[model samples]
Target: MKEWFERERAVHIQFYRRQPVVFVKGEGCYLYDVEGKKYLDMVAGIAAATLGHCHPKFIARVSEQLKKLVHVSNLYYTTPQIELAEKLREITGMDRFFFCNSGAEAVEASLKIARKATGRKKFVAFSGSFHGRTMGALSVTWKEKFRRPFEPLVQPVEFAEFNSVEDLEKKVDEETAAVILEPVQGEAGVYPATKEFINELFRLRDEYNFLVIFDEVQTGFGRTGRWFAKEHYGVKPDIMAMAKAMGSGFPIGGVGVSEEVAEKLEAGEHASTFGGNPLACVASLATIEIIEEEKLVENSEKTGKYLRKRLEELDGIKEVRGMGLMIGAKVENAPGMVSRSLEKGLLVNATSENALRFVPPLIAGREEIDFAVDILSSLK
Candidate 1:
């Protein structure tokens, strides 16, 4: 360890440690520590690098934009931001959009839109949902461990059972402003909502006239084998929040809203200082273009199926669930197994205390999956 790390051991910032190595560079599907030792990258910056790290296209676009305007306040329009927003509209069928600096900011904007559109204070969120850590986003997040220390969060946020239609029916009412959920819950060990549950969300929204917001931050940009996981169930939400893979590594987040809900917010109702800077927008555009040109979504679906099937047959795996490149394998003693995998040079996360999670890049193929399994099989 370096002297800086040793001295900062008692720092106030919370850190998530998975292995002893610190990454300094990344390529298609690998990371190199500062010492130049290489390891296969399976996390993809917690699912942020949909196109892998330091992609040639990304570098090219960002490099070209660095020579031009980088940022302009929301007061003025910029070409890159407008162009990117148009592409998003074409892809998602959302009429309007708002950009923000991070996933938390996008979630906060969604909440504000929901409240303003419905004129109701109470909002419904599902258990095991990880929206973001900001004050407003944290309000609706149901993880007790994350919310415990910050008591008295923004008021009137309600938690409903995940994937339980009956529970949602009982909790949602006329006073509810919106119902927020992750179509495929990522942080909750890759639990996917059933087709029935997805339909129920739309039904309840129609019955109660509340906005439905899908937090696609983890599953969007081809992570879940689709452009958006909501498409899997043929249901469309009033608003959608996405971020993790939107810029492929750059800090950017966005919210898409229906015309009905979007019209309520007049001029000066919302904005961000550094949300849609030229650099971030250009990077996002390049990522989307690469995904389309290379047909990475199809690869995610095919490769992910093979990987999931192989993982299900692995020793000590209790259950494997999820779609596309985003997968979770339940195992006994997940935390210990995760540490053991790290020691063996295969990286994975214990998303739940008893579940091993994998969110490899969309380009990960059978050879990589086989290597991952080989390493897991070696774990005692």
Candidate 2:
């Protein structure tokens, strides 16, 4: 394992500050390092593994598809891709969708569709929001550090204070083509938008004729106890970008657009070569089926509340925020807590300087939640 790490460090780009442990295998909500030490996975691949690691059903589905057909390109139609698209439409109530390979690509597609559909130039986003890292997604994402080096990004984007209706009103105008936001901000410490704030966006949309694009990359696929996070507010978006858990651990993403917006996007307007491959499509289908059949969404809501309640009882926790399995607890020393938790055989994320983010798989139950709490309780 040390040799492998050294070789990777020598050749690969240093994009991530990886942990010292080298994970060799995972099952359910647990991962095993190369030394055969087990660790509870609270991060869930940063909330991408909705069905947990190495799920038998997921593996079987992917294996079956690989034996038959894997990649036929978008030039021809395939059953798995169409079936997945239909499933997304059934779940999200959106008329159309475009497949991609990651959350960033989904956001990029939503941005382009918004411009083409509305014929406008400017876009409105909120503070403490993380859409993605690509140029278009980065333009709308908050955080000066990520944007500073990648200057001259996609232009005509404005940022407003998150959850501030007054700030949002002031920033959005007639020239704004779209207003993109996360129903629950993931990387920004799991801040869920207030109902008033989301409602205000719709109010402004009606008046200004701008589109509302919900960036649900982290909050969709039962992460928030709903099919999508926007459902919590009882409002639908003109466009929605989703990925994270859509393919379990497999990489896949998509943008859902309303009929009005879909009509404007013609062929050749956008495409992805490996976006809707058969393997990814089957993986997503299997993941969604498992989430539904196992009643994992309801479990996420119930177990999440229990976990949050437990965290709130901790002495050093300042606040607990978010819904379902996507939770963030503000503590005095988030980085220290994360490091200690890892040392104690638990995997979690220190999102911001003061917040510890928990995004366990939807399959997590009270036992898993209790184990995670035990680790945190020891810190106090």
Candidate 3:
């Protein structure tokens, strides 16, 4: 372990302060460290692993794809890519799809589409919002710590107080090319946008010609008890960016656009060399199928209600917020609690200074929640 740590420090950039434990393998909701200690993974790789670790169907599908073809690039048409697009269309209700490698790339594509289609530069984002780390996405992100170092990002982007209809009213105008936000803010303590706020934003979009973009990277793909978090508001966005759980553990992301915006996009305007590659598309297709076949979205809804009820009963928690399995509990010291939980064989993480986030796999049920809540209760 010490040798591994030293090697990491010497070879890798200090991008993240990772947990002390070094996991070797995972199965279902459990992870095993080098010392063979078992841990219940309640965070699901920060909501990226939709079907948990090494799900049989997920493995089988990907293995089959690997035996045949992998990356042929966007220059050629691939069946898996088109199949994944059709699945997304059924679930996302968008007219066009643009595949990408990661959530940040998906956000970049969405930002480009918004600007090109609307022919405007200014954008409106909300406080506590985390879009992505890419330049255009970073410009819309609200955290100063994430944005300040990358000084002079894509300009003219403004921030409105989250869920504040009055502030949003003041921020948006005809000059705004787009208004981008996560329906549920994951990094900023799992705060969800209110229906009133969404309704008002769409009303403003109708008045001004700016596009509305939803960054559903963390909250999409059954994490929020729905196919996408935008469905909670019952309003369709002009553009939507998704990733995280899209291909479970595999790296796959995409941007979906409304017909109006799709018409404005030209082939040469934007392209990716490995965007819609075969292996990634099959992985995503299998992920979607697993979510559908197992009814994990329903499980997320039912089990989440139970989990929230259990969390609310805990003594030390101030409040619990979020929909479905995507949740955050307000606590006294999030990082301290996370460490303590890890010591007790439960894997959880802190989203912010005082908030502990839980985004377990969509397949998680009442049994798993009970075990997690028991650990939490004991800690409290």
Of the candidates shown, which would achieve the greatest lDDT relative to the real structure? 2
Descending-lDDT candidate ranking? 2, 3, 1
Model 1 regions more than 4 Å off? 2-4, 7-12, 15-18
Better of 1 and 2 by lDDT: 2
| lDDT against the true structure, each candidate | 0.87, 0.93, 0.92
Which candidate would rank higher by TM-score, 1 or 3?
Answer: 3
Q: Indicate the TM-score of model 1.
A: 0.97
lDDT tens digits, residues 259-375, model 3?
A: 999999898888888887999999999999999999999888888889899999999999999999999999999998999899899999898779999999888888888898889
**Candidate 2 has which clashing residue pairs, if any?**
none
What are the clashing pairs of model 1?
Answer: none
Show where candidate 3 strays beyond 4 Å. Answer: none
Q: What CA RMSD would you report for each candidate?
A: 1.4, 0.9, 0.9
lDDT of 3: 0.92
lDDT of 2 by residue, 99-170 (tens): 999999999999999999999989999899898899999999999999989999987999999999999999
Q: Tell how far residue 70 is off in model 1, in angstroms.
A: 1.0
Which of the predicted structures, 1 or 3, would earn the higher lDDT when compared with the native?
3
Q: Could you tell me how far off, in angstroms, the CA of residue 300 lies in candidate 1 after the best superposition?
A: 0.6
lDDT of 3 at 236: 96
Worst 10 residues of 2 by lDDT: 371-380
